[model samples]
Target: MDALVLFAALFVSVAVGFALGRLSRRHLQSQYPKDYALNYYKGLSYLFNEQPDSAIDAFIGSLEVNSDTLETHLALGNMLRRRGEVTKAIKIHQNLLARPGLNTRQQHESQLELARDYIKSGLLDRAEALLLELVKISSAYKQAALEHLIEIYQDENEWDNAISAASQLDGKHYRPKSGLGLKQLQAHFACEQAQEDMAQRNFSKARTHLQEALGFDSDSARASLLFARLEIHQSRFREALDHLHKIPQQDADYLIEALDMICECYEKIGEPKALQKYLRSLLAEYPSNSLVIKIAERLRWLENDYVAADFIAEQLKQRPSIRTLNRLVELHLPHSEGRAKENLQLLKQLVDRVIEEKPSYCCNKCGFTGNSLHWLCPGCKTWGSVRPIRGVAGE
Candidate 1:
């Protein structure tokens, strides 16, 4: 179907070129060169034979690219790029760029399209050179060129370059149709830098990057989580707790990411009672199976298995979950007798398998599922879209 559409578009463009050429030269009593006429008919013959590639090549040979045919050339190149024929797209756009008859705007448009073709062909260095030139000299394409530069930097993991390109995008005028805003993307880039710093044990530099991340976007949950990790690494339990506590407010969907750090922070401070109080509050407010399991374990520790079992049972009435059910069965199995105990053990094993097989995270935008969270969705490339899976099979 798509091949047919391309063929039709190419046929129309060639026919239009023929008509324009005849109309323009009619007053001068001129005729098309024999080779041009032969190639044009050959292109039509190929189209009739459903040989699209050959047809397109023949059409290219037949058409005399000029101001009248520039737009048609661009549209054809764009369609080729969309069809994954990057090499052919590059040839067309490069031909346009090489033409001396094109005005400044046409040249800029051709450069942008050729840069895109380079990027699509995995020729980033070439694309970067052209895009950088456009970004500097062409006001009309600066924003678009910077966006492509950012994409290149991101793919290469050059966080600083990505940050610089993102900063150049006008926040007021450049609202993307999807994904994070510029500031949020900058924040994630900073967080990525901070993560690298922390991995190298450069806590001071990591802290600086985390601060810069927060300055870019104060509501960055990933930054908060990174800050908590930094503080916890340095044994600053109170500071870590402060950052971990900010995550739920920034984005409740990421609260699960902070839970383990929050627990460790409380334990490092020797405040088991405070941890229980906090877990209880989280249960009341967030109401997730993870929080439920945490509170249940605390209850079992502070009181007994019966108390934990009752709490899980009560919570399951409101939010049915396989994980919570598995925990509930575990809590009750030890005290059961004979046949009942055997049945409870079997039930627990079955529920455990079910929980283990379920995905822990899901992308809200594209429905990608995995056992671990991804800040950038693998399926859609949308930042912060993959989060903890919610409801019956998960948290």
Candidate 2:
């Protein structure tokens, strides 16, 4: 059925060509047998006979694309690419580039289209080279080429190259749709390099990269989070506590991320009681269900189940979350018996399923949801867009 529609569309193309020639055939047919009207008629006949190869040849050979019809070709190539026909789009754009009479601007436009075709074809190296040339040759596509180059560098996991390309967008009039600003994206690239160093256990190098990242964007809570983790790896509990504490100063929305790490730091220093007091102070200031949940768990570990359960129940009354509700069920499951035990079991399973199915992170820019957070949103490729899902169903 789709093939039939495609054939109909092809017939329409030939019909348009025939109509165009009809306006000028009397003057053109006497002078040239290669007249557009005659070629269109021949292509239509081949198509009617179901000889697609011959029909394609007739169509390609007929169109004498010039500056006057440049937009028509560009639009057709763009439509082909949009239809996932990258090879066909490449053919059209390549033909335009090979022409000798195009002006400099038209050549640049063709280069941009061909470069996009190369990108869609997964020819990253070819696309990168062509885009770099386009950046140097024409401001007409500078922003678009730079963005595509950044994407290519990211896909290659070349963090340094990505950072350099992103930095170039600072004053080049390339505005990010997420409003991340070039500086913030560069910071994310630095953080990515730092994460790589951390994975290799190169602590000092990771610290250096993280410091640079913080310098680039001081409001980056992700940088502070990494700094805290590095301190924890070194067993510098005091430093780690300080670093974790700084997350709130940067962005209070991310304070929940540091809760467990903060508790760990305090526990390492033999200060559970102090940790409890600090968390209470934070709860007073922040008013978040995540902080409340952490304090309840700390109480459960230090005091008794009743104390923890009561605290969580009271907090749930004020501000509730799926995470806290799951914890609540667990707190009473061990003590309940008979019908109460069975009821608790069912509730626990239901709540667990709910929490598992729900996404933990969401991209504010594009509304993409995931269980894990990403510094750059996979949907939008915008830095710092994925954030914790907050409210009753989440953090």
lDDT of each: 0.88, 0.82
Candidate 2 segments exceeding 4 Å error: 1-35, 42-58, 170-172, 270-274
Cα lDDT of model 1 by residue, 36-104, tens digit: 778989998998889977887887778767777787788888988998989888988988887788888
TM-score versus the correct structure, for each prediction: 0.94, 0.87
Question: What local lDDT score does residue 100 receive in model 1, on the 0 to 100 scale?
Answer: 82
By TM-score, how accurate is candidate 2? Answer: 0.87
What is candidate 2's local distance difference test score?
0.82
- Determine which window of 10 residues in candidate 1 has minimal summed lDDT: 28-37
Flag regions of model 1 displaced more than 4 Å: 1-5, 20-35, 49-52
- The alpha-carbon deviation from the true structure for residue 16 of candidate 1, after best TM-score superposition, in angstroms, is 3.2
Q: In angstroms, what RMSD does candidate 1 have relative to the true structure? A: 2.0
Summarize candidate 2's per-residue lDDT along 169-268 as a digit string, tens digits.
6455867777877777878888999999999999999999999899889888999899999999999999988888888878887898889899999999
Model 1 whole-model lDDT (C-alpha atoms): 0.88
